[model samples]
Target: MPPQQALAIARAFLPKRPWGNRYDYYYTRAKLRTDPLYPGVLAALRDTPGPVLDLGCGLGLLAHALHVDGQPRAYYGVDIDASKIERARQIARRTGLKDARFEVVDLGARWPEHTGNVAILDMLQYLPSQVQAGMLAHVSRMLAPGNKLVIRSALGDDSGRGRTSKVTDLMAHFAGWMQEVPKSYPTRESLEGHLANAGLSATFSPLYGNTPFNNWLIVAERRAG
Candidate 1:
């Protein structure tokens, strides 16, 4: 869908739920969903035989967007924020998403032991470098042979040449916002190594809609033990 139309759809569907974080959310979701990376996620999400797991699923924007476009299977969105998860739960209820659920869980310390397709969006950066690696390892160990890990993150650091854009974006992201962006981000090389360390073969792709973003995605899979 066109970005404008998609934005409108998100705005329209959001208010029906009294608990949704309607402010600044549609803008974020609209940009992400219309992003090129979303098609890849859609294709991967469609192929999952079971549910999709959304880690750090703030306010269920991604989940809602997926449901809005058309997701074939059940999805579970996990997050650390109780209120956001509650909002997510409410959104699910209001939208009649029988296949989607939300819960408060921080996968950084350790993801709950469960098995299914999972998508970790822009959450790793918040974790310290070692923590991020360990988290990836935990997720990898949990994944089955066919289970997938879809990761998204902001990229560039300071130079905007993939060297320093992340810092810039983080500063810009929180300049006037209530919450600060995440920290402990791995460099591109380190990001790939995290997946490899976790025993998952991974590939990275760029996501659009934001400039000077260290925004890119990584998809990984676990091999049968």
Candidate 2:
């Protein structure tokens, strides 16, 4: 999405009161302009069918992006932050986005019952390795043949970009954007192994566009038996 287009979307997030709305507006603008996460996820989900269950969806940006891009898929976004969820709901309602919903749910504790494509973006590192593994397994089960499970995360490594991602996440925690400090970052090998164990194949690609983070987009698919 271009900066001018992103500016238009950020307008939807602007709150009624100017007190805290500026933060959301600027954050959404910066994220949409600088991060390539939304476009990448949209491309991965383009040909897929059925509703989308977006785990760890913050402020439901993906839903908004999907609506803007004319995907027309039902978007159910869940996150642990109630405030963010509420704001997402309000935006969706105000924008008259059809079939878009948001809910506050602790992803580490439970997942909503869903059967379709799944997306876990930029939130896996906050969960422990075991929790992340379990979540992957559950997502794998939910995915029907030919459906996708898309994930965007910073793969763990010793490179400068990897270190930068770690530090950035920590700063987000300290800055109150994230309530939990990142516990573990998954490596490419580990994520591939987990998907394979669940009878899925994954393709990983760099998603860092004009950014210094080590983010990668992993698109996993369940083949027909």
TM-score of each: 0.80, 0.96
In angstroms, the error of model 1 at 39 is 2.6
Estimate, for each residue in 80-171, the C-alpha lDDT of model 1 and write its tens digit: 87877786787567667777788888666567665777787767777778888877787776676677888877653554545555655467
Full-model lDDT, candidate 1: 0.68
- Model 1 stretches with alpha carbons more than 4 Å out: 1-9, 16-29, 32-34, 156-158, 161-181, 223-225
After TM-score superposition, what is the CA distance of residue 184 in candidate 1 from its true location, in Å?
1.1
Model 1 TM-score, 2 decimals: 0.80
Q: How many residue pairs clash in each candidate?
A: 12, 0
| Candidate 2 local lDDT, 155-186, one digit each (tens) | 99999999999999999999998887888899
- Among residues 3 or more apart in sequence or in different chains, the pairs in candidate 2 whose N, CA or C atoms overlap within 3 Å are none
* Local lDDT at 220 for model 1: 84
Ten-residue stretch with the least lDDT total in model 2? 15-24
